[model samples]
Target: MGSVIEREHSATGSMALGQWAVIGMCMLFNMINGLDTLATAFVLSSLSAEWALNGFQQGILLSASLIGMASGSTFAAPMADRHGRRPLLLASLLLSGTTMLLSFWAQGPWSLALLRALTGIGVGATLVGANVLTYEHASLRRRGLAISLQSVAFALGVSLGGLLAHALNETVGWRYVFLAGGSFTLAAGLTGALWLRESFEFLAVKSLPAQQADHRPALSNVATNSPVPSLASQRLFGRGYRQHFSTRQWRETISLATAFFLVMFCFYFVVSWTPTLLVQTGASETHGIKGGMLLNTGGMLGALLLGLGANRYGSRQLLLGFLLLNAVLMTLMVPATQVLSLAIGMGFTLGLLLNGAIAGLYILAPQIYGTGERASGVGLVLGLGRLGSILSPVVAGVLLDAHWSSQALFTFYASSLLLAALAIAWGRGGTEERAGRSRN
Candidate 1:
């Protein structure tokens, strides 16, 4: 029995070369996903000028990819559970890149919107797949840090894309930006195909218990000791899948999904509208671009800080504090906008806290489910959360069209943050109670 346990430990030992390779590839994938996701924002002013788009039309264009993202996260990303993370990730990269390239030839708003939506499908799937891969590859001790680093990579991509757009929009035109992003995505896809491996935990779960019987003694020992539930016994789908989860599991998923939805509502509104909002408030188009970059810059910093502190301070406590602070900062944004420097500074700080809240979610998400359900669990949360993204731009645009002040719009967004904080607080309480019961 002791020998069997030793073999099991060896077989399931710490992350190795393949795991590191997956982490590096996931980082690159997330960076490209970020670039593609935010590229529209960087080019929105230029695209509007060229296409002669109205506020409503522009809102549709901004929301188009987000709609696609929601669809992909809901429907396409879940396929990773059945087919394999690598295939879905590679396919998403290819599809998104091809569609984004096609966007450069768009003749009007309708064509561009269609292309953007298609690109978003790829971006959304890649986001989910890459995250699952990252989660599975890291050692249990470092998983939170790995996920947070991925967010940092994504944040850098957003900032870099904005800086690139600001530099090239006047000289090369917006079409070139699409061309560049598409080319990079295609290249990254090739790299991923060549280097990325499927998750080992995924493989272990898919293996039949009979086939893994030799390791059962060790596995049983692990089940008794580890916090992570054993996935070897769970079915991959259907009634068996439903039977796998208890009421507490379902409640945890629902709570996380709700918090994710509320936070994303606020996040997408800022990412999709901050530049345009700045322009509307009398800033130059260049200042608008700079504002977007500053926002993402703060996000990178926020993610870094969270990664460093999350293990020591506790993720839930940090998340709750970040959300409340973000609420305050966003409310203060109203007055800050009256001064250009102050507004830019506040945008950075708001982005930091906003992304800190998001990073907190990313840290907590993987802890809630085992390998068998991790992809689907994270995908569902993200897909549902994207409803906020899909709705915010269009709704905010209509309100702006009706002559709502920028201050009023921000105040409304701040309110969403408060609601999100409440959701997280509730989730924390439930999780703690569940942990206590499990311990007793």
Candidate 2:
């Protein structure tokens, strides 16, 4: 009687088609986000030439979307916890798609920056929806792998973007790249509106306000005796939120935020800057793009490995390992650049560890919050992390202008990961939170 039907132990790896579809679609959205993000990095060579831009100007262009992402994470994503995820996710896709399409007409740095910033907002909010939806929908056994695969989608997108950028940049020019990203995104959004399934848990929670008694059985259509009545009243930062905001949760949030920030600071710097930095190192533009692709390819494998290994070793323990490896990789980047093969190899390995760390963080964050606050908690952590993402590129631009070598930059960013490892070690949720997950 105390059990929720869906929570019953399943044969390992068993997943419903609906659950797979939701997670699969979320992966597609993440792919779109990745392509849209790296679109600017690929186009920078053309953009600088066209606009006569300086390092700072290019940094603005790169960072504009991230600023919007930060805002979306802080403000727009939290709304998913209150409203439904499907609509917000669909709306974000449409918004980003339209803005990206409109980017074809950008006249100057600020014009393109403005459009990109708007795109960032959509992408940022979509990030929250994708993670939360996947977390809520996936079964306990396959949950880690599903979430990790969702994270891999972004890396897949970046790998494809690198290839596409090289192909399209030379043929149709940079504007077409934005057009492609926009067209694909809008397609996903329109289709998602028609097909995306609302989370049963979200539905069950929503139904609680209208039916105070025995809500789960009616709303879920799955046998369940457990009823969490208090979820319906939990508004983020409102009075109901007070019910879950314990001192322990506060500490967990801070530590998660810190870990997210540091890891992401390094993540963006590597992905966004690797190609450009490689180009600066006398490699041709083609090799530069290859450098970027290699990173994401390694990332895909690394995340998959982490997911597969998660059930054996704990998620937090594997995550800390990834974080530590990342610091080591960053420190090695300078030496790797001395040889062409070594440079490419290092990019791939670093990407593996860095992207793996990110996937690990995404998998970890949602486990700390309940159905009611999951989106908000993850969004807050991701939003704070985007600050690091937003800051990294601009800082690189400034440091580059100041004549900082790639070695210095790589070494400097590596320390952020070392610190991030410490944060990960410290970010485990308190015993009360563990008890809650046990209850679930």
Candidate 3:
């Protein structure tokens, strides 16, 4: 079985038709899932007016699907490990598509939130299926490049979704936006149910449960945390802070998790609020939609840029550079808001830096862990990042409710990114020092 697995992984260059099909399907899933996850954001302005939502309520609405994503990540992603990737993927797609379709009739913020949460479950679960299947399908040499496209597809989805929402919202109404996303997602699910192939690696692992008990069959295994990056210091600032990171693995884990948390915190804040805020500045939904689209458009480019740079410069170094750049961009975001073009340009730049930072983390995470703990370590980092994602909008909302200005809010988040950059640098230095000691 191991020999067969090695042979399959050894195939290089062009993939089989079946392999391309599976990988393409997963990318499609990721793309639609992106649209489904951010569906509410597209119509937030209308929803606010219809429901007379306060900043806090609006925050909850923006955050509802994220909360669902966390739930799905916890409960559903793991199911693929047990039930099989194919089944999980199909089920999650159907679940997400159905909920998104149902969202067209959501009566209030709470109802919309409920539907969005369900959609997020599917979104969350599909991530596991997409990532696992992508890794399993691609040739070994091209695996990293292929899997990175998932991030590109996600950004594409959001960008296209902005265009879709504008057209639909202008022609008909906001409900149509949800309806469109749900229908397309459902159509994809149906197509996938018929055509999507199971992961050969998954089947191989299942053939020998004895060998799989302690480790994933595919450990280099595209550690996406389902499409991402965390928070803790010696258990996040405990007594043995120095001793805690004395070990190489622990140092990597803590530093990476902290970096993940801070980046996601800032990333979600920008993703969740930019459209609405942009709308406020110009008194126009077009401004918001354009800003949102440009942000994602930049992200698509950023993912590619990171992929190119990681190949030449190194993922860790490039990631730190992106993070530091993002911190500066975040602080300047408010000033950009005053001018429509400037605001949108800043959004694009921030998207480039922020998404690049995120893709960098995803690219680097699996490298830091051994097979036995890859899943756990990546999961921990991802979970913390999700927590940050969930909290960011709510925190922003509360601050805004208290009448905080955009400049202050952005500056505060920038500080988190700076701290995150520092953590990554510290981890790199500490891990190197520890290895130096061991070698001696």
TM-score of each: 0.85, 0.87, 0.78
The reply for model 1, stretches above 4 Å from the true place, is 1-18, 166-168, 210-233, 238-246, 272-288, 338-341, 401-405, 428-440
- Could you tell me the lDDT of residue 36 within candidate 1? 89
lDDT of each: 0.77, 0.79, 0.72
Q: Order the candidate numbers by TM-score, best to worst.
A: 2, 1, 3
* Candidate that scores best on TM-score: 2
* lDDT top scorer: 2
Q: Compared to the true structure, candidate 1 yields what TM-score?
A: 0.85
- Count of backbone clashes, every candidate in sequence: 0, 0, 4
Candidate 3 Cα outliers beyond 4 Å, as residue runs: 1-14, 49-56, 209-253, 272-289, 333-344, 366-380, 400-406, 426-440
**Residue 244 lDDT (model 3):** 27
lDDT of 2 by residue, 289-347 (tens): 78887888999998988888875676778888988877887888877777888889989
Clash count, candidate 1: 0
Model 3 Cα lDDT, one tens digit per residue, 147-242: 667778888888788779878887898999999998999899898989997766556444544534334334223222221111121112223223
Candidate 2 Cα misplacement greater than 4 A, ranges: 1-13, 209-229, 237-245, 272-286, 397-406, 429-440
lDDT of 1 at 283: 89
